[model samples]
Target: MEYNLEVINLTKNYQDFHLQQINIKLPKGKIIGLIGENGSGKTTTIKSILNLMTYDKGNIKIFGKDSRNLTKQEREKIGVVLDDSFFSPILNVNDINKLMKDFYSNWNEKFYYETIKKFKIPDNKPLKEFSSGMKMKIKVLCAIAHEPKLLILDEPTNGLDPIFRYEIVELFNNFVSNGENSILMTTHITSDLEHLADEVIFINDGNIILDVLKDKIDSEYGIVELLENNFNNIKKEDYLKCLKYKNEWYILVNPKYEFQKKYPKLKVRKPNLEELMLLLVKGE
Candidate 1:
């Protein structure tokens, strides 16, 4: 199947940070979660793909067209929610709706009004008067109102309450159910992705460390908690990451079958996204 988005050899350089040869692909009809620590190049990668920043070396394609040379029509197929509100704070929800209708030819005024109502956004209140959570909801509302085929979300759920967050996640699930739409989101809430993501990409300090389907990760890797004495006994090559507390060891390993079979005395459990990320990001 053709990919909805593809990035090959994506590289960027800054005074103190570098986004090295990052490569990623998002297939149609899938929600891929991008996870990284603060300043790990998630925003940089998104900006590069959005043509907001120039990269030194790489090719980014969306809808099989070069990202850098997208036509107006091609650009319309994407919906973006960045870290901050891109519009003027003086604009109210109604004003935003009017502006977007003028900008995106496909904008659905009906849907926009309904969504704002559903999200409990006050039409007359200026964006500057809204709380952070309210601002985030407006951004999300604006992004989906045009019915784009692809969504590029950066910290999409920041400042959202749990109730709204859950609702948005459910909306995302429905968005891709038709098998034509796709989403690339970077969120700190790994728990949300643990439930909604089809695949997870882990990036660290500019390098792509792991990119795998959620199912494959669960089936292929397992976390083993080992006592100090048992840590040296397991085969080291099996370990993808290992961390030590006071005396216990948290080991993330591949070929889980072999490790589990060999060490019947230890318990092996599937690690959630957060646990896996912690091991990869914090462990040695």
Candidate 2:
């Protein structure tokens, strides 16, 4: 039951936005997918975890040590891939390799080069000249070159093609196969989470709204579409959330099997991650 990262009562406030007391736990050897709409505080939470920004109140623990007090050696055990952070675009593969060698004591140059060759990334091209997908691949490679135990990534698959995204997903699967490493990633692509994540945390308006196992999302949660009259017939206590679309209504119900038993013809079905988020965020 060891956790790789824990956020306890984390809170940050701004003039127009507030990240309320947030709590998250990333267990070792698991992939936790953080999901939310744009400007919903996904990036803010990540920045706070990385100590890139200060929070008003909370405790963040990484590897059981206060994140703020992590030693240089301890910091090296974590890899980070931020959507807007990277080495200067002018730097090429060799330059980055040279810089990383000085930055991390365990930099794996051989493995880095092998990965570069496997991905067909040019060794001499500047990052500025690479496409978004290429740049993303390089960033991921750089993050893992140091052989870290935990990876924190923001929007790692934002602009990749299906083929590349599949490859990256496979790479992530391989990363945790050893049962010692873990990854925390944020992406708008919930489908990827359906295939890769062990747990999913949904954040909205700077607050965590739902945290559950990926399997439970399918096995225990259900979605029902019906007309307003039929929707009103269902007891409020039986469903978690509901949304209205013109003449139709969608309800998110837990323990769908029971709901199905009650309304046998209601067409209750499991929700995909995206549908679940939509109902949670926009449903009343």
TM-score for every candidate vs. truth? 0.96, 0.96
Model 2 agreement with the true structure over 1-284: per-residue lDDT tens digits: 99889999999999999999888888888999999999999999999999999999999999988999999999999999999889999999999999999999999999999999999999888999999999999999988999999999999997788898899999999998888899999999999998899999999999999999999988999999999889889999889999998899999999999998888988988899999999999998
**lDDT by residue for model 1 (1-284), tens:** 87889999999999999899999899999999999998999999999999999999999999998998899988998999998647999999888888899999999999988888888888998999999889999898888999999999999889999999999999899999999999999998998898789999999999988898999888988999888888989777778899997799999978788888878788889998888999999998
Q: lDDT of each prediction vs. the true structure?
A: 0.91, 0.93
Question: Which stretch of 10 consecutive residues in model 1 shows the poorest summed lDDT?
Answer: 232-241
Cα lDDT over the full model 2: 0.93
* RMSD list, candidates in order: 1.3, 1.4
